[model samples]
Target chain A: MDCVLGIDGGGTKTVCIVMNAEKEILGRGETGASNYQSIGINAAFKSIELAIENAVIEALKTIKSLEVQVICLGLAGVNRPRDIEVIKKIVNDLQKSHRLPIMWELEQIIQPDNKSNNIIICHDALIALVGGICRDVGIVVAAGTGAIAYGRNHQGISKRVGGWGYILGDEGSAYQIAIAGMKAAIQAYDGRGELTSLVDVFTNHLQLETIEDLIEFVYRRGMGVKDIAAFATLVDSAAVDGDGVANEIIDDALGELVKATFTVIDAIFCPHIPNPSPQTIRNDDFEIVTTGSVWKGKSNIRERFIKVINQKYPYIKVILPRFEPAYGAGLLALKQYLQKSDSKAAH
Target chain B: MDCVLGIDGGGTKTVCIVMNAEKEILGRGETGASNYQSIGINAAFKSIELAIENAVIEALKTIKSLEVQVICLGLAGVNRPRDIEVIKKIVNDLQKSHRLPIMWELEQIIQPDNKSNNIIICHDALIALVGGICRDVGIVVAAGTGAIAYGRNHQGISKRVGGWGYILGDEGSAYQIAIAGMKAAIQAYDGRGELTSLVDVFTNHLQLETIEDLIEFVYRRGMGVKDIAAFATLVDSAAVDGDGVANEIIDDALGELVKATFTVIDAIFCPHIPNPSPQTIRNDDFEIVTTGSVWKGKSNIRERFIKVINQKYPYIKVILPRFEPAYGAGLLALKQYLQKSDSKAAH
Candidate 1:
């Protein structure tokens, strides 16, 4: 039976899903971090290989025989033609190493062949957009530890805003929010800003006795981005519990996210006019997929995000992901494979 | 002759000044970085030893013989009692290793011993404050690659604001300014923000064909904080050339610096009120010495900072550093050594 594999590779983990021609998920697999930037290319690929092998092993229990004719990978840091080329080399290496349950010759989907041309490689945001809306077109607002606003129009035009990472940008990201919270706490401690309960919140959450210990904890202890980002939950909880500073911080973060979303929308969807007023730029109804852990916070960030979006574009809809990103990748691969096969049959 | 040594150790390099009881510069030396946070303790101490050796070697040319009364070291990351303990062990190690050009036994300046108790270790900010206005009192608004606002009242009460590093705070720092400039360029490129010449500025400065190359340069290729902070000069130049976006970034940066200065002033110099209004908090005429490369920008950051600060506290006079930080450290050591000697003689 014809099968397809979809993979979503990230810094923390790699998730894979196996689907049949009928779009039924046959198997699922997960493995450790596959971010080539953080982990070396070999380790990252090893995780992908292990995930694929595990997923195929599970699929074998259900189907008598399976042929993975298509595979789509949505990975982080897969920007630029050079990045795609690097991924292609790794895929070629995987095929040459013969580290698969089923034999499949991989190639770009454009060069259709029965024995080849069955792979699609793209960035993580694309899969999130596709998975969230269950389609290839629309915007995806991803605000986990890092934040990015990305979208693809019907004409296949794509645009992105704010994904500059924790240092330069990531304005609405959990990392930024957490940093703002910590800054507010420090400021309050220093008598530099408005008094806030975040001083207590950070102290208790981190099991610290005084806010001054934060310098030792934050710098001396060598806290990673993820570790810092984890504090966003505290900020959210504080905001929900009515801490004025935390609420303002969240408000500012959401505003930045909305701005990034609006920028993406204007780029790919709005009319191409230099400095066109929002009233001058007309847009059709569109569903924007909101993904990542930030949405799940108790601060009503999603509700606030939707409210603000509606204020700007009442026709636009904000939603949670309808499917996993791996599933979306699988769907994309399956559609491409079926479309090419049908076209060949017609010819 | 009773001489004193003042060493300023930082991330980039270490500077040492040898001074006499007459407050005359006997010798000067410069060496590699001694920031133990960046380089290891051994290497940092080695740098300090080399700078001190060189300075003392030059001082020998000026004097027949020298009795070193005291030495004060101002280094980065010398915070907390624990950090001081760690530095003390290293000082012991440096002394035990017998690495000095002259056999000078060291101890804390408080011990008041001839053969020992001659070293005083403090944070880099204190040296900058003393060095800038050539005093133990008054505030120092430092806006280098990183920034911090630190002040000591006449009564020796000290307070600080900002200096939270690149990720947390560093509001008015060159790193922050460069980051803001880059963010603006990216926003302008994405059509999310107003169009600015910063896009061209970054591209030209970085020798890239397009602004998108920044993504490749920033993320793909590793760029350090100092390298990014170097772009602050470009932002300053742009602001000087009348770029509205760059001007706004500079204005915001200066405003944050002013706020930090006010915060420090309020904490140390102003009356201890829970929330004293500006009118209620009258401060004595104290010069806030402005140090760091950011002040040298063509954008008139220093001028703008002065203007904003005067608007709030007219008595808060802003001035450039009157002396180098190492000289200030020497001055501090000289004063402490003289005060202790005079007290012992009186007894």
Candidate 2:
């Protein structure tokens, strides 16, 4: 069976899946973070290699032999040409040392930097777009620990807003939500802001004896941006329980996400129409997929987003992902391979 | 010579000043940070002890025998009762171990739990207020790496706003300004925000070859909040050079500071006047002092702050610090000592 390897790697973990050309997922494996920028090139390569080997081993249990065609790695923090080149070199080294039967054309392996479409290296945004919409082009609002609005037009032109991390951006992210919640609690405690349930919510949830202990709890080494982002759920729950401040926070988060999404849409999807109003730019052809933990909140955040987005861009629809990004990578590889084969057949 | 010891301890450094009852400065000393929450209690104690020892040693060169009547310590993160108790215990141990000629009256030394007015332990806000106003009562806006608006009435009731640190608050702080500059530059680079000089300014000033390199520059180990706050000077410079975005950011920051200041004033100073409009609060009796490096910017931030604040509270005068915080601590101790002597004579 001819299959391709699709790997999705980020700051925390890596997942690689084996899929046949027909888009059926055969086997999957997981490993620690494979971001070269964070874990170093060698460690990242080892993680990718380990995941690939385990995935291949898992697939072998059913298939007698498998011919691996291509590998697509959609990774985070890979935005520039230099980053792509570095990841390509790592892939070149991986094929040389690994036991997988990678059927790279002879000349391509000899000269790794040459133009070979077999290996695809790109940013996580591409995988997110393809995976979220289950197609090549659309928009995605990712509101996890960090937030970003990304969109790719059919012409392959992509635009992104936000994603500047906790300090600079993450406007609609869980991190921002959590920060706003904490700030409101602190301000209310100082007798400067309106009273909110977040004060008691954070205090009770964090198991803090007093609200002042929150300072020590946050500045301590163990609690990082992700851990802080986790507290955003409590704010969402408070909003669900009819807390005024928490509801306002959720509304603000939605407003920011919607604004960012509109920016992306205007840049890529509606460039021909000058000064397209939010109500007029009704893009029906592409779906707006909402990803990350913020959408999974107990509050009607997702429903509210859909209602507001649809009311503004009446033709557009908001959705959840049909498949994971690793599977999307496999589908993308098969797509490119088939496209190339069709062009060759026409010739 | 009848003198008192006053120490101002913070996250970066500690300062100790020795002054006589007549408010004559005799000697001064400096040491590293003495925040026990950040650096352990032992290290904080040693720093304080070293600063006090150096000051007393320097003062002994002029006076035959220095009798330290009282001691006042205004330290950061010393807010709760537990924190004050811990600092008081540290002070007690220091007097027992060192040679400061502390006149504890035989009771405070044997049973340290007793209420002896000789040692004063307080939050940094009190020292800032006393030092900034050169008296015991007023509001002081401290906008350094962190921002806080604090005010105390003559009746001794104090109120604070902000000062929640980089993650939670720091509304008008240098850190927030720097983060805003970084965000604007990144947004402009992504074509999602207005083009501004901040992009080129941050890129060239930071020595970054590409804007994307800023991610590594920021998230990499060595760049903490203070280092990030240092970049705020560039934004101020850009505003000075007529960058619209930078100017707007400055205006927004000033607005937040003014808002926090009003909150502090309303809490402590304006309790009798409910719903007093910002324009109607013409407080001529007390000064509103502004401190920290943000006031040192060439962008006329301090001047603009004064203009806006004075416009709102017509009769309220804003002024710079009349003395350093450590010196202010000495003045506070001397004032208390003289007041105590007057009360004893009345008795």
Candidate 3:
């Protein structure tokens, strides 16, 4: 029985799934973080190996024998080309070591076939785009700890906007919203900005009495991006309770999201008049898929984003993902497997 | 024979000046940074002592046997009451040690007099206000690595707006401007924002090939507030050379500064109708003093700031400081000396 493995690796956790050739889910397993940048390559290797082992073990319970044909990993922190080479080497070393039972079993089962299997590695956003729309040609607007909009046309041309992290970009993300809320609260305390209920909300949430204490909490104590991003919910709740400052912040964030989405759509679909030599995709019919925690919440940012996008780009359809990113990775691996087999048969 | 010592201590350098009863500039000296928060309290004490000793030595060149009457220090990072007590104790210890010739000479000469001399420690804005306006009753709009608008009424009541550092506030400062410029460059590179000349400006300035290199430079390489703040001049130059994005950033910064200044002015000058019980300083006439490097540059931010303030608060007069903050500290010490002598004569 032919099977493929898909892995979604992030800074906090890793998920692995097994699927048959027909794309039916066989087993799923989760483990610790596999982001090599944060947890180091060795630990990331261990986490990925553990997740694959547990997933293979779970799959074996329902099947007599399984031959793993291909693997795809959608990982965070895979930005530069150097990162791909580094992660590929780590995965190759893991395959050669054959330390885990799943790897050894797969090696024995696939030895007679003499067919070279493949391992695909890509940025997490790629899997998100595929999983969100379950296709290759659409846009994915992800707003979590950071934000980015990735779009692909039918011609295989891809474009991205605003994945510059918390410092440089991430304009419509949870981190930006939380940071704006914190700044507003501090401005209110300094009597330089409009007063908001966020002052009390943040003070109680962070267990701080005065807004001045936030100085030490943020700068001195060193809060991480995700830790700060967690406060976006409080800002959303405050906005829901009719705080004008919080509402403005949410509105600004939605505006940024709409602008970013529009930029991605224009870059991928629209061709410039003066310099039209770049083989533009020129597809008007595509979906704008939304993902990440920001979309899951009750905040009207998504509604406003859809409203603006619909008004501006009527051909673009807004949607929520049908499957998780891990499944999307599996689908990508299956697509790659079919493509490779079809090319071999054609030759 | 009586002289007053005034010290202005900052993160980068410290300045001290000596003024006699007639307010003559007897001597001036400079030394290293004395901000205790960054460079330990002991080092701060040593810097302060060295500056004072150098000033006295220079004064001795013109006059003989100078009796130091009062000392006033306007130091950076002197925020809370605890900071005041800590700095005061350091000053007292330095006085007790009398390690320098100036301290010993002044101690021996003033020992016979039973009158208690004074040492006043205050935030740098207070001295900037005094030195800028040649008096205490006015507003000081300081834009440096950070921005703050501080105002003092005739009744000794003072209030400050902004100065929450680079992250939470400092909206109109060089750091904010540079960050905004960098963000615009990245946004343009990502095709999410307007194309601007800042992309080439930052790429060449930071010795980077692409704008994406800024991610590693800012996040991985640990670029600091001052280092990033240094790029503000480049943004200014880019704006002057007709960069639309840079011009927009400058305009936004000017708008923030105008709003902050207006807030400080309203809080200090305008009395609330419902809660009028607080002792209101009913002075309609006061100068708005401008200081810091932002005012020195040719950028229209300052001109726009002045224009906006003039249009809104027509009664408030805006002017540049007449002297440096160190000379203002000397004036403050001289004022304290005269007031003490007047009370002694009355008794």
| Cα displacement (Å) at residue A63, model 3 | 6.6
- CAPRI grade of model 3: medium
Per-residue CA lDDT of candidate 1, range B218-274, in tens?
Answer: 776688889889999999999999999999999998888988988887777875776
Q: Rank the candidates by TM-score, best first.
A: 1, 2, 3
Off by over 4 Å in 2: A36-46, A80-93, A96-117, A275-284, A336-347, B39-43, B67-69, B80-117, B275-284, B335-347
The CA-based lDDT of model 1 is what? 0.84
- Over B11-79, each residue of candidate 3 has an lDDT whose tens digit, in order, gives 889999999988888898899999887789889988888888788888888787777778889987686
Q: List pairs with backbone clashes in candidate 2.
A: none
DockQ of 3: 0.57
lDDT by residue for model 2 (B1-347), tens:
77888999999999999888778878888999999987899999999988988888888888876777778999987877878888989887886864664443323322245577778888787898898799888899999999999988878888888887888788889999999999989888877689999999988988988776788788754598999999889889999999999988888888888889888878877788887665445542688899999889898888988898777676788999989899878878888778777877998
Per-residue lDDT value at B56 in model 3: 82
- Best by the TM-score measure: 1
Interface C-alpha RMSD per candidate, 1 decimal:
1.5, 1.7, 1.4
Docking tier of model 2: it is medium
Location of the lowest summed lDDT over 10 successive residues in candidate 2 chain B = B102-111
Poorest 10 consecutive residues of model 3 chain A by lDDT? A103-112
| Model 2 chain A lDDT-worst window of ten | A103-112
